[model samples]
Target: MINLTGKVAVVTGASRGIGKTIAKKLHQAGADVVLVARNRELLEKNAADLGAAMVVSMDVSSADEVQAGFKEIIREKGNIDILVNNAGITRDNLLLRLKEEDIQQVLDVNLKSMFFTSKSVLKPMMKQRHGRIINITSVIGLMGNSGQSNYAASKAGIIGFTKSLAREIGSRNITVNAIAPGFIETEMTAELPETVQKEMAESIALGRFGSTEDVANAVLFLASDLAGYITGEVMNVTGGMYM
Candidate 1:
Protein backbone atom coordinates (compact mmCIF):
# COMPACT_ATOMS: atom_id res chain seq x y z
CA MET A 1 0.00 0.00 0.00
CA ILE A 2 3.03 2.24 0.38
CA ASN A 3 3.83 4.29 -2.68
CA LEU A 4 7.47 4.71 -3.71
CA THR A 5 6.87 6.50 -6.96
CA GLY A 6 9.89 8.48 -8.18
CA LYS A 7 12.14 6.89 -5.56
CA VAL A 8 15.32 5.05 -6.48
CA ALA A 9 16.23 1.74 -4.86
CA VAL A 10 19.25 -0.52 -5.22
CA VAL A 11 19.45 -4.22 -4.43
CA THR A 12 22.68 -6.18 -4.50
CA GLY A 13 22.84 -9.90 -5.41
CA ALA A 14 19.64 -9.19 -7.26
CA SER A 15 20.14 -11.77 -9.96
CA ARG A 16 18.52 -14.52 -7.90
CA GLY A 17 16.85 -15.71 -4.72
CA ILE A 18 15.68 -13.22 -2.10
CA GLY A 19 17.56 -10.37 -3.72
CA LYS A 20 15.78 -10.88 -7.03
CA THR A 21 12.42 -11.05 -5.31
CA ILE A 22 13.12 -7.88 -3.36
CA ALA A 23 14.05 -6.03 -6.51
CA LYS A 24 10.81 -7.06 -8.17
CA LYS A 25 8.77 -6.14 -5.11
CA LEU A 26 10.31 -2.69 -4.93
CA HIS A 27 9.74 -2.17 -8.60
CA GLN A 28 6.15 -3.19 -8.17
CA ALA A 29 5.81 -0.57 -5.44
CA GLY A 30 6.86 2.08 -7.99
CA ALA A 31 10.51 2.58 -7.07
CA ASP A 32 13.11 2.77 -9.80
CA VAL A 33 15.00 -0.42 -9.04
CA VAL A 34 18.63 -1.07 -9.83
CA LEU A 35 19.87 -4.64 -9.81
CA VAL A 36 23.43 -5.33 -8.69
CA ALA A 37 25.12 -8.68 -9.13
CA ARG A 38 28.32 -10.28 -10.39
CA ASN A 39 26.59 -12.12 -13.19
CA ARG A 40 26.08 -9.72 -16.05
CA GLU A 41 23.92 -12.09 -18.05
CA LEU A 42 21.57 -12.70 -15.19
CA LEU A 43 21.59 -9.09 -14.16
CA GLU A 44 20.80 -8.03 -17.72
CA LYS A 45 18.01 -10.54 -17.98
CA ASN A 46 16.52 -9.43 -14.67
CA ALA A 47 16.89 -5.80 -15.61
CA ALA A 48 15.19 -6.37 -18.89
CA ASP A 49 12.42 -8.26 -17.19
CA LEU A 50 12.04 -5.40 -14.73
CA GLY A 51 11.73 -2.80 -17.51
CA ALA A 52 15.40 -1.96 -17.77
CA ALA A 53 15.75 -0.01 -14.56
CA MET A 54 19.52 -0.50 -14.33
CA VAL A 55 22.16 -3.15 -13.80
CA VAL A 56 25.51 -2.89 -12.10
CA SER A 57 27.81 -5.89 -12.36
CA MET A 58 30.59 -6.02 -9.81
CA ASP A 59 31.85 -8.15 -6.96
CA VAL A 60 30.64 -6.36 -3.86
CA SER A 61 33.43 -7.88 -1.74
CA SER A 62 35.96 -5.51 -3.25
CA ALA A 63 35.80 -2.06 -1.64
CA ASP A 64 37.14 -0.38 -4.76
CA GLU A 65 34.63 -2.12 -6.99
CA VAL A 66 31.76 -1.17 -4.73
CA GLN A 67 32.96 2.41 -4.62
CA ALA A 68 33.31 2.66 -8.36
CA GLY A 69 30.02 0.90 -9.07
CA PHE A 70 28.04 3.16 -6.78
CA LYS A 71 29.69 6.18 -8.25
CA GLU A 72 28.44 5.14 -11.64
CA ILE A 73 24.95 4.51 -10.32
CA ILE A 74 24.77 7.87 -8.60
CA ARG A 75 26.03 9.60 -11.69
CA GLU A 76 23.16 8.14 -13.70
CA LYS A 77 20.38 8.00 -11.10
CA GLY A 78 21.30 11.22 -9.26
CA ASN A 79 20.22 9.85 -5.85
CA ILE A 80 19.53 6.66 -3.97
CA ASP A 81 16.50 6.41 -1.69
CA ILE A 82 16.74 2.78 -0.64
CA LEU A 83 19.60 0.29 -0.43
CA VAL A 84 19.25 -3.44 0.18
CA ASN A 85 22.50 -5.09 1.15
CA ASN A 86 21.51 -8.57 0.06
CA ALA A 87 24.65 -9.91 -1.57
CA GLY A 88 26.07 -12.74 0.51
CA ILE A 89 27.81 -16.12 0.31
CA THR A 90 27.88 -19.08 2.65
CA ARG A 91 31.09 -21.02 3.24
CA ASP A 92 29.98 -23.66 5.66
CA ASN A 93 32.16 -26.04 7.66
CA LEU A 94 32.94 -26.96 11.23
CA LEU A 95 35.34 -24.58 13.00
CA LEU A 96 38.21 -27.05 13.17
CA ARG A 97 37.75 -28.16 9.57
CA LEU A 98 37.04 -24.78 8.02
CA LYS A 99 39.81 -23.55 5.81
CA GLU A 100 41.31 -20.08 6.22
CA GLU A 101 40.16 -19.11 2.74
CA ASP A 102 36.66 -20.22 3.60
CA ILE A 103 36.52 -17.93 6.58
CA GLN A 104 37.97 -14.97 4.71
CA GLN A 105 35.75 -15.45 1.66
CA VAL A 106 32.60 -15.72 3.74
CA LEU A 107 33.48 -12.62 5.70
CA ASP A 108 34.41 -10.68 2.61
CA VAL A 109 31.21 -11.39 0.70
CA ASN A 110 28.72 -11.49 3.56
CA LEU A 111 30.01 -8.92 6.06
CA LYS A 112 32.60 -6.75 4.38
CA SER A 113 30.39 -6.26 1.34
CA MET A 114 27.75 -4.70 3.55
CA PHE A 115 30.39 -2.36 4.93
CA PHE A 116 31.48 -1.38 1.48
CA THR A 117 28.00 -1.02 -0.02
CA SER A 118 26.56 0.79 2.99
CA LYS A 119 29.47 3.20 3.07
CA SER A 120 29.10 3.80 -0.64
CA VAL A 121 25.47 4.85 -0.24
CA LEU A 122 25.91 7.00 2.88
CA LYS A 123 27.05 10.06 0.98
CA PRO A 124 24.04 10.11 -1.33
CA MET A 125 21.59 9.12 1.38
CA MET A 126 22.93 11.74 3.77
CA LYS A 127 22.86 14.33 1.07
CA GLN A 128 19.24 13.57 0.34
CA ARG A 129 18.42 13.37 4.06
CA HIS A 130 16.15 10.41 3.48
CA GLY A 131 16.99 6.77 2.90
CA ARG A 132 16.42 3.17 3.87
CA ILE A 133 19.16 0.59 4.39
CA ILE A 134 17.92 -2.95 4.78
CA ASN A 135 20.52 -5.63 5.39
CA ILE A 136 19.69 -9.32 4.86
CA THR A 137 21.18 -11.16 7.77
CA SER A 138 20.15 -14.63 8.98
CA VAL A 139 18.70 -16.57 11.90
CA ILE A 140 21.95 -18.50 12.15
CA GLY A 141 23.57 -15.21 13.14
CA LEU A 142 21.26 -14.81 16.11
CA MET A 143 21.58 -18.37 17.36
CA GLY A 144 24.24 -20.60 15.79
CA ASN A 145 24.46 -23.46 13.34
CA SER A 146 26.72 -26.47 13.87
CA GLY A 147 28.52 -26.41 10.54
CA GLN A 148 28.30 -22.79 9.45
CA SER A 149 30.66 -20.99 11.76
CA ASN A 150 31.99 -18.59 9.16
CA TYR A 151 28.58 -17.68 7.76
CA ALA A 152 27.15 -17.24 11.23
CA ALA A 153 30.01 -14.95 12.19
CA SER A 154 29.58 -12.81 9.10
CA LYS A 155 25.80 -12.48 9.54
CA ALA A 156 26.22 -11.67 13.25
CA GLY A 157 28.75 -9.03 12.28
CA ILE A 158 26.08 -7.53 10.02
CA ILE A 159 23.68 -7.16 12.93
CA GLY A 160 26.29 -5.16 14.82
CA PHE A 161 27.15 -3.14 11.74
CA THR A 162 23.49 -2.38 11.08
CA LYS A 163 22.88 -1.12 14.59
CA SER A 164 25.98 1.06 14.69
CA LEU A 165 25.29 2.59 11.29
CA ALA A 166 21.66 3.24 12.18
CA ARG A 167 22.71 5.16 15.28
CA GLU A 168 25.29 7.14 13.39
CA ILE A 169 22.89 8.17 10.58
CA GLY A 170 19.49 8.26 12.24
CA SER A 171 19.78 12.00 12.73
CA ARG A 172 19.84 12.40 8.97
CA ASN A 173 16.53 10.60 8.48
CA ILE A 174 18.28 7.55 7.06
CA THR A 175 17.09 4.36 8.74
CA VAL A 176 19.39 1.34 8.82
CA ASN A 177 17.96 -2.06 9.69
CA ALA A 178 18.65 -5.76 9.29
CA ILE A 179 16.33 -8.61 8.27
CA ALA A 180 17.21 -12.07 9.53
CA PRO A 181 15.60 -14.80 7.45
CA GLY A 182 15.25 -18.30 8.85
CA PHE A 183 14.98 -21.36 6.66
CA ILE A 184 14.09 -19.91 3.30
CA GLU A 185 13.62 -22.15 0.27
CA THR A 186 16.16 -21.10 -2.30
CA GLU A 187 18.53 -22.74 -4.74
CA MET A 188 21.01 -23.26 -1.92
CA THR A 189 18.51 -24.98 0.30
CA ALA A 190 17.21 -27.06 -2.60
CA GLU A 191 20.62 -28.69 -2.74
CA LEU A 192 20.41 -29.76 0.89
CA PRO A 193 19.54 -33.38 1.59
CA GLU A 194 15.78 -34.05 1.75
CA THR A 195 16.10 -35.14 5.37
CA VAL A 196 17.88 -31.93 6.30
CA GLN A 197 15.21 -29.85 4.57
CA LYS A 198 12.45 -31.71 6.39
CA GLU A 199 14.21 -31.21 9.69
CA MET A 200 14.51 -27.49 9.01
CA ALA A 201 10.85 -27.24 8.04
CA GLU A 202 9.77 -29.07 11.20
CA SER A 203 11.74 -26.61 13.32
CA ILE A 204 9.86 -23.61 11.96
CA ALA A 205 6.61 -22.67 13.65
CA LEU A 206 5.11 -22.07 10.23
CA GLY A 207 5.67 -25.75 9.47
CA ARG A 208 7.43 -24.96 6.21
CA PHE A 209 10.41 -23.24 4.77
CA GLY A 210 9.76 -19.61 3.85
CA SER A 211 9.52 -18.47 0.28
CA THR A 212 11.55 -15.67 -1.27
CA GLU A 213 8.36 -13.60 -1.45
CA ASP A 214 8.03 -13.70 2.34
CA VAL A 215 11.39 -12.08 2.80
CA ALA A 216 10.70 -9.65 -0.05
CA ASN A 217 7.49 -8.50 1.58
CA ALA A 218 9.37 -7.68 4.76
CA VAL A 219 11.94 -5.74 2.75
CA LEU A 220 9.16 -3.84 1.00
CA PHE A 221 7.67 -2.85 4.34
CA LEU A 222 10.99 -1.67 5.77
CA ALA A 223 11.82 0.22 2.61
CA SER A 224 8.50 2.02 2.69
CA ASP A 225 7.56 5.19 4.60
CA LEU A 226 5.59 3.06 7.05
CA ALA A 227 8.89 2.10 8.68
CA GLY A 228 10.22 5.64 8.84
CA TYR A 229 10.18 5.63 12.62
CA ILE A 230 11.90 2.26 12.85
CA THR A 231 15.69 2.13 12.89
CA GLY A 232 18.57 0.43 14.66
CA GLU A 233 16.48 -2.74 14.69
CA VAL A 234 16.60 -6.29 13.39
CA MET A 235 13.39 -7.62 11.86
CA ASN A 236 13.25 -11.40 11.86
CA VAL A 237 11.48 -12.98 8.89
CA THR A 238 12.03 -16.33 10.55
CA GLY A 239 8.51 -17.76 10.91
CA GLY A 240 9.04 -18.00 14.66
CA MET A 241 12.03 -20.28 14.35
CA TYR A 242 13.64 -18.16 17.07
CA MET A 243 12.00 -15.71 19.42
Candidate 2:
Protein backbone atom coordinates (compact mmCIF):
# COMPACT_ATOMS: atom_id res chain seq x y z
CA MET A 1 0.00 0.00 0.00
CA ILE A 2 1.10 3.59 -0.59
CA ASN A 3 2.37 5.13 2.62
CA LEU A 4 2.89 8.82 3.43
CA THR A 5 4.08 8.56 7.02
CA GLY A 6 5.88 11.69 8.23
CA LYS A 7 4.75 13.76 5.30
CA VAL A 8 3.11 17.08 6.03
CA ALA A 9 0.25 17.56 3.59
CA VAL A 10 -2.12 20.45 3.14
CA VAL A 11 -5.52 20.19 1.43
CA THR A 12 -7.49 23.30 0.58
CA GLY A 13 -11.31 23.52 0.37
CA ALA A 14 -11.29 20.58 2.73
CA SER A 15 -14.37 21.41 4.66
CA ARG A 16 -16.48 19.08 2.52
CA GLY A 17 -16.88 17.10 -0.68
CA ILE A 18 -13.88 15.87 -2.67
CA GLY A 19 -11.39 17.93 -0.71
CA LYS A 20 -12.64 16.50 2.57
CA THR A 21 -12.30 12.94 1.33
CA ILE A 22 -8.83 13.62 0.00
CA ALA A 23 -7.72 14.95 3.35
CA LYS A 24 -9.20 11.94 5.13
CA LYS A 25 -7.47 9.48 2.82
CA LEU A 26 -4.12 11.19 3.18
CA HIS A 27 -4.47 11.28 6.93
CA GLN A 28 -5.37 7.62 6.97
CA ALA A 29 -2.14 6.94 5.10
CA GLY A 30 -0.28 8.42 8.09
CA ALA A 31 0.55 11.89 6.80
CA ASP A 32 0.22 14.92 8.98
CA VAL A 33 -2.76 16.70 7.44
CA VAL A 34 -3.77 20.32 7.49
CA LEU A 35 -7.33 21.27 6.64
CA VAL A 36 -7.74 24.69 5.03
CA ALA A 37 -10.89 26.59 4.17
CA ARG A 38 -12.84 29.77 4.87
CA ASN A 39 -15.08 27.94 7.31
CA ARG A 40 -13.21 27.82 10.58
CA GLU A 41 -15.94 26.05 12.46
CA LEU A 42 -16.24 23.28 9.94
CA LEU A 43 -12.49 23.03 9.59
CA GLU A 44 -12.10 22.78 13.34
CA LYS A 45 -14.67 20.01 13.48
CA ASN A 46 -12.92 18.10 10.74
CA ALA A 47 -9.55 18.56 12.37
CA ALA A 48 -10.91 17.31 15.64
CA ASP A 49 -12.44 14.29 13.94
CA LEU A 50 -9.11 13.45 12.38
CA GLY A 51 -7.75 13.27 15.93
CA ALA A 52 -4.53 14.97 14.77
CA ALA A 53 -4.66 17.70 12.16
CA MET A 54 -4.08 21.44 12.04
CA VAL A 55 -6.71 23.82 10.74
CA VAL A 56 -6.03 27.03 8.87
CA SER A 57 -8.79 29.46 8.10
CA MET A 58 -8.18 31.83 5.23
CA ASP A 59 -9.36 33.03 1.86
CA VAL A 60 -7.10 31.17 -0.55
CA SER A 61 -8.18 33.44 -3.40
CA SER A 62 -6.25 36.33 -1.89
CA ALA A 63 -2.48 36.49 -2.27
CA ASP A 64 -2.04 38.25 1.05
CA GLU A 65 -4.22 35.74 2.86
CA VAL A 66 -2.38 32.82 1.32
CA GLN A 67 0.98 34.27 2.31
CA ALA A 68 -0.05 34.80 5.88
CA GLY A 69 -1.77 31.44 6.10
CA PHE A 70 1.27 29.61 4.80
CA LYS A 71 3.45 31.41 7.28
CA GLU A 72 1.27 30.11 10.06
CA ILE A 73 1.37 26.64 8.60
CA ILE A 74 5.15 26.69 8.32
CA ARG A 75 5.43 27.94 11.85
CA GLU A 76 3.35 25.08 13.19
CA LYS A 77 4.20 22.24 10.84
CA GLY A 78 7.83 23.19 10.13
CA ASN A 79 7.86 22.13 6.45
CA ILE A 80 5.37 20.95 3.86
CA ASP A 81 5.84 17.84 1.75
CA ILE A 82 2.56 17.76 -0.16
CA LEU A 83 0.25 20.48 -1.41
CA VAL A 84 -3.18 19.70 -2.87
CA ASN A 85 -4.70 22.74 -4.49
CA ASN A 86 -8.28 21.54 -4.38
CA ALA A 87 -10.05 24.75 -3.57
CA GLY A 88 -12.46 25.93 -6.25
CA ILE A 89 -15.87 27.40 -7.00
CA THR A 90 -18.26 27.67 -9.91
CA ARG A 91 -20.46 30.51 -11.14
CA ASP A 92 -22.52 28.97 -13.86
CA ASN A 93 -23.99 31.26 -16.52
CA LEU A 94 -24.07 31.56 -20.25
CA LEU A 95 -21.33 33.85 -21.54
CA LEU A 96 -23.82 36.47 -22.58
CA ARG A 97 -25.62 36.33 -19.22
CA LEU A 98 -22.51 35.84 -17.06
CA LYS A 99 -21.88 38.78 -14.76
CA GLU A 100 -18.45 40.34 -14.62
CA GLU A 101 -18.26 39.67 -10.88
CA ASP A 102 -19.10 36.00 -11.35
CA ILE A 103 -16.34 35.63 -13.91
CA GLN A 104 -13.85 37.39 -11.67
CA GLN A 105 -14.85 35.35 -8.62
CA VAL A 106 -14.45 32.08 -10.44
CA LEU A 107 -11.07 33.11 -11.80
CA ASP A 108 -9.85 34.30 -8.45
CA VAL A 109 -10.98 31.30 -6.42
CA ASN A 110 -10.57 28.50 -8.91
CA LEU A 111 -7.51 29.66 -10.84
CA LYS A 112 -5.62 32.38 -9.01
CA SER A 113 -5.83 30.59 -5.67
CA MET A 114 -3.56 27.91 -7.02
CA PHE A 115 -1.04 30.57 -7.93
CA PHE A 116 -1.03 31.96 -4.44
CA THR A 117 -0.95 28.64 -2.60
CA SER A 118 1.60 27.05 -4.92
CA LYS A 119 3.90 30.04 -4.72
CA SER A 120 3.64 30.10 -0.94
CA VAL A 121 5.15 26.61 -0.69
CA LEU A 122 7.79 26.90 -3.40
CA LYS A 123 10.55 28.32 -1.21
CA PRO A 124 10.31 25.50 1.29
CA MET A 125 9.87 22.80 -1.35
CA MET A 126 12.73 24.12 -3.47
CA LYS A 127 14.98 24.54 -0.45
CA GLN A 128 14.45 20.88 0.48
CA ARG A 129 14.45 19.88 -3.19
CA HIS A 130 11.44 17.64 -2.60
CA GLY A 131 7.67 18.08 -2.76
CA ARG A 132 4.47 17.01 -4.48
CA ILE A 133 1.86 19.39 -5.84
CA ILE A 134 -1.47 17.94 -6.84
CA ASN A 135 -4.17 20.09 -8.36
CA ILE A 136 -7.83 19.08 -8.66
CA THR A 137 -9.17 20.19 -11.99
CA SER A 138 -12.32 19.00 -13.80
CA VAL A 139 -13.49 17.36 -17.03
CA ILE A 140 -15.40 20.52 -17.79
CA GLY A 141 -12.04 22.21 -18.07
CA LEU A 142 -10.88 19.77 -20.72
CA MET A 143 -14.17 19.78 -22.65
CA GLY A 144 -15.95 23.06 -22.65
CA ASN A 145 -19.45 23.22 -21.14
CA SER A 146 -22.26 25.65 -21.74
CA GLY A 147 -23.18 28.00 -18.85
CA GLN A 148 -19.84 27.32 -17.22
CA SER A 149 -17.42 29.39 -19.17
CA ASN A 150 -15.83 30.91 -16.07
CA TYR A 151 -15.39 27.54 -14.39
CA ALA A 152 -13.99 25.98 -17.55
CA ALA A 153 -11.54 28.83 -17.96
CA SER A 154 -10.38 28.54 -14.38
CA LYS A 155 -9.89 24.77 -14.58
CA ALA A 156 -8.11 25.06 -17.94
CA GLY A 157 -5.77 27.61 -16.41
CA ILE A 158 -4.88 25.11 -13.71
CA ILE A 159 -3.76 22.65 -16.37
CA GLY A 160 -1.49 25.27 -17.91
CA PHE A 161 -0.18 26.30 -14.52
CA THR A 162 0.51 22.72 -13.54
CA LYS A 163 2.50 22.06 -16.69
CA SER A 164 4.48 25.30 -16.55
CA LEU A 165 5.26 25.03 -12.85
CA ALA A 166 6.29 21.39 -13.13
CA ARG A 167 8.86 22.22 -15.79
CA GLU A 168 10.11 25.18 -13.79
CA ILE A 169 10.68 23.06 -10.65
CA GLY A 170 11.34 19.59 -12.02
CA SER A 171 15.06 19.93 -11.44
CA ARG A 172 14.26 20.60 -7.83
CA ASN A 173 12.62 17.16 -7.43
CA ILE A 174 9.13 18.58 -7.11
CA THR A 175 6.45 16.86 -9.13
CA VAL A 176 3.35 18.83 -10.11
CA ASN A 177 0.30 17.21 -11.67
CA ALA A 178 -3.44 17.71 -12.03
CA ILE A 179 -6.44 15.40 -11.66
CA ALA A 180 -9.50 16.17 -13.77
CA PRO A 181 -12.57 14.53 -12.32
CA GLY A 182 -15.59 13.90 -14.52
CA PHE A 183 -19.07 13.63 -13.08
CA ILE A 184 -18.61 12.71 -9.43
CA GLU A 185 -21.10 12.24 -6.64
CA THR A 186 -20.97 15.07 -4.17
CA GLU A 187 -23.25 17.33 -2.16
CA MET A 188 -23.73 19.49 -5.21
CA THR A 189 -24.46 16.59 -7.49
CA ALA A 190 -26.86 15.08 -4.97
CA GLU A 191 -28.99 18.16 -5.37
CA LEU A 192 -29.29 17.72 -9.11
CA PRO A 193 -32.53 16.35 -10.51
CA GLU A 194 -32.68 12.62 -11.15
CA THR A 195 -33.20 13.22 -14.84
CA VAL A 196 -30.18 15.45 -15.02
CA GLN A 197 -28.07 12.94 -13.17
CA LYS A 198 -29.23 10.10 -15.40
CA GLU A 199 -28.48 12.12 -18.51
CA MET A 200 -25.02 12.98 -17.26
CA ALA A 201 -24.29 9.38 -16.29
CA GLU A 202 -25.41 8.03 -19.64
CA SER A 203 -22.58 9.91 -21.32
CA ILE A 204 -19.96 8.16 -19.22
CA ALA A 205 -18.83 4.71 -20.30
CA LEU A 206 -18.95 3.70 -16.64
CA GLY A 207 -22.71 4.38 -16.72
CA ARG A 208 -22.65 6.06 -13.31
CA PHE A 209 -21.28 8.98 -11.40
CA GLY A 210 -17.97 8.38 -9.61
CA SER A 211 -17.62 8.46 -5.89
CA THR A 212 -15.49 10.95 -4.00
CA GLU A 213 -13.33 8.02 -2.92
CA ASP A 214 -12.45 7.42 -6.53
CA VAL A 215 -10.85 10.84 -6.82
CA ALA A 216 -9.25 10.56 -3.39
CA ASN A 217 -7.59 7.32 -4.37
CA ALA A 218 -6.13 9.03 -7.44
CA VAL A 219 -4.83 11.88 -5.30
CA LEU A 220 -3.23 9.43 -2.90
CA PHE A 221 -1.41 7.69 -5.72
CA LEU A 222 -0.04 10.93 -7.12
CA ALA A 223 1.04 12.01 -3.64
CA SER A 224 2.79 8.73 -2.89
CA ASP A 225 6.34 7.75 -3.81
CA LEU A 226 4.86 5.28 -6.28
CA ALA A 227 4.33 8.25 -8.59
CA GLY A 228 7.63 9.95 -7.86
CA TYR A 229 8.70 9.91 -11.50
CA ILE A 230 5.40 11.30 -12.80
CA THR A 231 4.95 15.03 -13.27
CA GLY A 232 3.30 17.70 -15.42
CA GLU A 233 0.51 15.31 -16.42
CA VAL A 234 -3.24 15.40 -16.04
CA MET A 235 -4.83 12.25 -14.65
CA ASN A 236 -8.46 11.98 -15.71
CA VAL A 237 -10.76 10.29 -13.20
CA THR A 238 -13.76 10.63 -15.46
CA GLY A 239 -14.43 6.91 -15.93
CA GLY A 240 -14.21 7.15 -19.72
CA MET A 241 -16.62 10.03 -19.77
CA TYR A 242 -14.30 12.32 -21.71
CA MET A 243 -12.08 9.88 -23.51
Best by lDDT: 2
Candidate 2: stretches off by over 4 Å = none
lDDT of 1 by residue, 136-185 (tens): 99999999899999999999999999999999999999999999999998
lDDT of each: 0.93, 0.94
Q: Please state the error at residue 1 of candidate 1 in Å.
A: 0.9
Can you write out model 2's per-residue Cα lDDT over 1-243, one digit (the tens) per residue?
Answer: 989999999999999999999999999999999999999999999998899689999999999999999999999988999999998888787999999999999999999999999999999999889999999999999998888899999999999999999999999999999999999988866876798788889999988789999999999999999999999999999999998
Record all residue pairs in model 1 with backbone atoms less than 3 Å apart, i.e. clashing: none
How does candidate 2 fare on TM-score?
Answer: 0.98
Cα distance off (Å), candidate 1, residue 189: 1.2
Which segments of model 1 are wrong by more than 4 Å?
none
* Backbone clashes under 3 angstroms, per model: 0, 0
Cα error of candidate 2 at position 45, Å: 1.0
